[model samples]
Target: GRNEKISAEARDAILARGEELGQALAERLPEVEQLLAMPGADQIEVGKKLRGQAQPLIDEHYRTVLRLKPRLAPIKAAVFPLKRNHDQLVATAKEVRRRLQLGSEMRTVYDDTGAIGKLYRRQDEIGTPFCITVDFDTIGQGKDPALAGTVTVRDRDTMAQERVPIAELESYLRDKLRG
Candidate 1:
């Protein structure tokens, strides 16, 4: 059976707990402390280690998707308008993508070639870490006025989503990539 999907906050908490445990162990063992202070695995080694990590998600023997984490994913984020017919949404998506790319190392793309599902599947297959969807709420046209300036961020692995303010998107994604 598939594992229960966890939210970003939950994952962060779990990581923090693990770090605490590792630190406690390090304090009791000198060797562990030295290892903890040492640098991490090199990019090539990490790449080689993660080479076989990419997985395909299958659903009902019909749909399949490639999975990757930020470390392995070339494209970090994907921006898309809720509907191609909506001029404002399309413009917002483009603007969001532009903002995400300016002076940043993040690789972002604006996609509207087909339905949202198909677009998501393409991103998943290509190992995109996250997807940002600009919808009516983001443009202040939806029922919720408070959701303006926020986009829906979807995690490709867990398929979990959260509403994130556009202003903090870059930092948010950067932190995720680091971890």
Candidate 2:
């Protein structure tokens, strides 16, 4: 399910971007043709301008488009239990990862082998955009009832943490990735 959906979305996005590129070049075709129809000196001047300015713009545009692609994203998110010892927390984390995978085509990972800090670092090294940690708070074992069913979502680049309810986690991640 995820494999097919992700691959299809990836294909469609690439094709759409490619079409956009083609249209962009087509829009400039008339101008290029007019420049080429001029005298040899004018043609040389136009070529110089294109090489110095237009080519760099096109290259940058393509790079930006490529970077924005979701399929190219290594891991959509990482899931970790606060510690490996707690069976319940670990199970919750696994379920969270499973639910996220079901909701979208993005890749999800579950890790319960290390300390939370180390897990976060590993995820960062692997280029994961977000890390979700399930702790006692997630299972209503904590004093704060308000934190029940919520996980700590950490940003890879920023290392920022936000508490997000399990029910909304997938949609929140999708929105964050989209933006």
Best by lDDT: 1
How good is model 1 by TM-score?
A: 0.65
Give the per-residue lDDT digits (tens) of candidate 1, residues 1-179.
Answer: 11135444544444454345455542334433332333331122322222222112112123455666686788899999999999999999999999998949888999999988788888888889899999999999999999999999998887899999999988898988998
Looking at model 2, residue 62 earns an lDDT score of 32
Compared with the true structure, all predictions reach lDDT values of 0.73, 0.70
Cα displacement (angstroms), candidate 1, residue 168, comes to: 0.7
Question: What's model 1's overall lDDT?
Answer: 0.73
Candidate 2, residues 1-179, lDDT tens digits: the string is 12332345554444344344445664565444444343341224334444454444443333221122344577788899997888898889899999998878978989877777667767666677788989899999998999999999987656689999999998898889887
Residue 20's lDDT in candidate 2: 47
Q: Give the Å shift of residue 62 in candidate 1.
A: 4.2
The root-mean-square deviation over C-alpha atoms between each candidate and the true structure, in angstroms, is 16.9, 18.4
lDDT minimum window of 10 residues, candidate 1:
51-60
